[model samples]
Target chain A: MSEYQLPAQFEEFSQARKEGFLRAKAIKDSGGHIAGTFCTFTPCELMDAAGVHPVSLCGMSPEPIPAAEKDLPKNLCPLIKSSYGFAVSDTCPYTYFSDLIVGETTCDGKKKMYELLGRMKDVYILQLPQGIDRSYALEMWTKELHRFKAALEEKFNVTITDQALREAAELRNQLRQARTALMELQKLDPPPFTGLGLYKLLDGLGFSFDLHSNLKKLTDLTAQLQADYAAGARPVPPGQKRILVTGCPIGGVLEKTVKVVEENGGVVVCFENCGGIKPTRYLVDTQAEDIMSAIAQRYLNIGCAVMTPNSQRMELLPQLVEEFRVDGILEIELQTCHPYTVERYEIKKLAHDMGVPFLALDTDYSQSDVGQLTTRIAAFIEML
Target chain B: MPVYSIGVDIGSTCAKLAVVEDGRTLVHQMVMPTGWSSAETAQAIYDQLERQGYCPDSSPCVATGYGRLNVPYAQKTVTEITCHAKGAAFLFGTEACAIIDIGGQDTKVIAMADGVVQDFLMNDKCSAGTGRFLEIMANTLCVDPGTLCELARRGSGVSISSMCTVFAESEVISLIGSGTAKEDIAYGIVESIVNKVASQYGKLSVPGDRCYLTGGLCESPYILESLSRTLGLTVTSHPLARYAGAIGAALTAHGLARSERRTSV
Candidate 1:
């Protein structure tokens, strides 16, 4: 391993979740409202405008899966099982403190899991369109945003004004801009931070509700990294094969995929997954005539596998490959994630056309396949 | 003095060693049961090399396979995937071909173009499509793997549906209880593994029509024929195909030795 140490901010970001739990408890004690979101499609601006804090409650651990399997099928996606498991077992403080939990019809597993989740908590389901190419997708998503806004107002008893929505959108856009700038720093010859470091920071940002503090921390970390690099600190060794990770959300499989890749002659320079460039690259247009429609449009354009004909992903992949100077593409699909697993063929074809080697690994949040994953990833790095 | 390069492949079932003279000639080869401990197997391989008048410590050596890390004397270690691809390419004397290596724990299908691995796929963490699956089924049938394949040649009119080795073993026991012919049950076992391998091969977009077979099953003509028939392509193997991983490791050792000499000069 390289003896280079990550800045203190990376550690601080990784601990954000634990700190946020205490913060959420304090807010609840003071009679403040908190909303829990499960997907990237949630219009968090509505929650912000209604004086409610939105915290991401997507499950990225395997501890609660067995309990979830009692209610959910054993063959379902681990993310769904984990999320449902946390809620049913009352293990997650965020879920317990949430005034309302927002869910979107992203995939079959999550859609059904929400049905059961709704029975447990104050759940509100947003009917998301499956395809972005149709004209009705934007209109329907816009209407859903309005409905979500009304739900928040009714539950919190605070009417959200258009100016408040616009202001919330502007603050969220600035946060996104800060995240994008930090992510693009990996485009350097040798990335300033390892993929694990970058992932921790990005995943940690979702739990942090203070937008201004989050933005400041990101910029400060970016500056620290740049100054260190200028002073001849290369955290990643030169000549390691640059890898770009794409597919399902990678928080559950980070040790098996990203960490293994880095341990064996390669460095993960880019992550096109949910927590990385995918959701951060697009910003809500705060200046549009209707801020709700602009927010809906931006969220609808996410390159998720749930969307049929995910052209945004197809388009973004090649651009990322070139900009990152990627030598290989590794797609990590969780077990039973049908949309990403099925979409792997198209991603492979795209990698092949671009003259890059691609490898797809289907795994669950278990340690049983670590040996096999190590050999496969090591051989892939050797091939590059 | 002539400097020989050594390749050691400590697989799950067997350990193979190859010594190459000046990177081109196959000067010596050896194979032995891997036993329960890879570290002991590696020690035995070293002792055998010393008895054969080869200085393992002095020679440039590369270790491979699942137990590659256990070889203490190896100068470097490479994964079985690259070693197998390089060794099969050398044995078949072709730069562009697909290689299917069925080992004790896993089955790997690799596409080689211009003497490099273009793409590859392995069976998921299951023993269904691998050589271990056959061995377990053979044990249940009271026959060795070779005899089971031989029995498969004459049997027909039966099939095994379970892809899992343990489940398939129970399925075979039930067939025995039902008075199903041993030959017919044997045929089902071979068919199950052959079909699994064929399906895995179908997943890769191989570059050439030529496909090569390597590993322990390479010596079984019935397996070769069954795989060839199932894939609709002539899957060929040589007598030394089982030693491809070791040979590839030796070849890598040769390259490293040559480069070190150049740098020293």
Candidate 2:
């Protein structure tokens, strides 16, 4: 048998998981016997601390979900079907690993989904009480936060002092600042970081950020990236627009469409890859009177992937364009990627209305379409 | 001649067409599969329209279903929940109805208040409790929707222990191999389907009297016969059931078109 390998770090799938996982682990890993707290988010962080890795289980085998169709509405997205299928088949590995499956009330689908799946004994839900903009909402979240913290304390019998959270916050701040620097660096003449390299560095943020020595080591690593660059000492080709695309890589086609833009004489600086945003954008003041409230304020208020009443994807477009001072935003679209496709439609309408001419490129992010996207991107840049 | 309304339901297995005149369905039919090509699917629909000798282009066409977006010529895309509720209310003439629609891909349980959707839960991830589930069960039993419904109506008092299609198929296969009655197994399959519907409807505060089911699953007499079992009250099945979504869309379009003409006048 191969030697058992340990993963470098543990990560929550979404921001919600980050908060909930930390809550559970902060108490549990301290080795206390308190019952676990429930949040709407899954238990990635808590699991990691418990020496369990939480994988975001998205798809299903289609075997069990077909039966659930009788019990569920037809208009629901496929994601929920898989959730039910997972439960019906007992297919979720995390089911054994997870002490608590916390869920946020983001939509009607997730709420119903959790409720339906709550047939299992241990999974708990920390619903985001209604009245999103109300003070009561804030109070509710704060109370939930405290309750969650207490549950962690009770479960693991660990006393997480305010000081620890402050330390966590400071570490998070450093990571974010480094990310901010990386963002600024993208504006340089030839652009400093490739989207792929930027995503990898951002991915390395969450685990090491909690440990100061590790974070210091990371800071040294980021510093030496400059040396690595200096060592290579190669310039980008002339007459090419050093543009970074700030778009979510949705379909498998993101790379294909990206190649298209590159061929079109534009170089992609970043994808605003969710991986880049999550670890690098931890903006909460963990030292506040209510750490949970601070975290919520940081996450909900930000125009990131989870903070959506509107697809603030376009918001990233402008920032990346001006920072990178991109010649134009080549909005690569997958014909069926509903979220981005709709966002592209609005972006196009707004571009036309505002006279901010940006190219909207549509192709099934197929590798075959790489040459086509590159050609179009080259033309859009030349037009500018 | 008065201006009329129409509803179009794009289901997984079929494209259902419904023509509503004065909030009532005059004609309804289900077309075949939406082929691999969108244009081919659209053309098949177009040909069906020409065969029926109706000009869908002349009317305001509101489409509903998983393939609602794929309906190239739809004027608007209304969710299946809204369309189902409208169809149920139009068919049953009831203001408050619990509309359970079991199509091929998913099952949706919707609570309708005066032909408007109050809340809904969709089972987009499963083939259980849906028309597709029935298709599988029927294949196991060697029957179609028409014969399966008849068998379900004719039989009673059997339980389908499994919900997983894979296991259920095996169970049915084993039962047939063992010498279990075909009617009993069919009844069991239909009952399990009803149980699945019951699980979804259990979430909503569905009223006892006004519960109706639409879509191909309802085409099974055995399933509806099993559904006749009470959920604190009686559940009724309508004849125009499966075609309800398309009828609602057509009716909605017809009404909208009439209002537009009235404003112009």
TM-scores across all candidates?
Answer: 0.95, 0.46
DockQ values per model:
0.45, 0.01
Error of 2 at A21 (Å): 27
Task: Please state the error at residue B261 of candidate 2 in Å.
Answer: 18
Off by over 4 Å in 2: A1-384, B22-39, B51-53, B153-158, B217-221, B230-232, B255-265
Error of 2 at A193 (Å): 25
User: In terms of TM-score, which candidate is strongest?
Assistant: 1
Q: Among these predicted structures, which one has the highest DockQ?
A: 1
lDDT of 1 by residue, A160-245 (tens): 99999999999988888988899899999889989988998888877777789998999999999999999999999888889999
For A1-384, candidate 2 gives per-residue lDDT tens digits of 213221123342346534544544443455422222222133223333333323334332344456556677755544456456654554333332345555666445656777876776355566555434565766776676566556655654566566655555565567567666665555555655654455445444432324456456556756765666567643444455654453333323445555445544566665554434423454667558865567555544433323344444445555555555565555554343355555655666655554444665555322444433443343345334
Q: Where does candidate 1 clash, by residue pair?
A: none
Q: What is the per-residue lDDT of model 1 for residues B114-183, given as tens digits with 9 covering 90 to 100? A: 9998888888998998989999999999999999999999998888999878888899999999999999
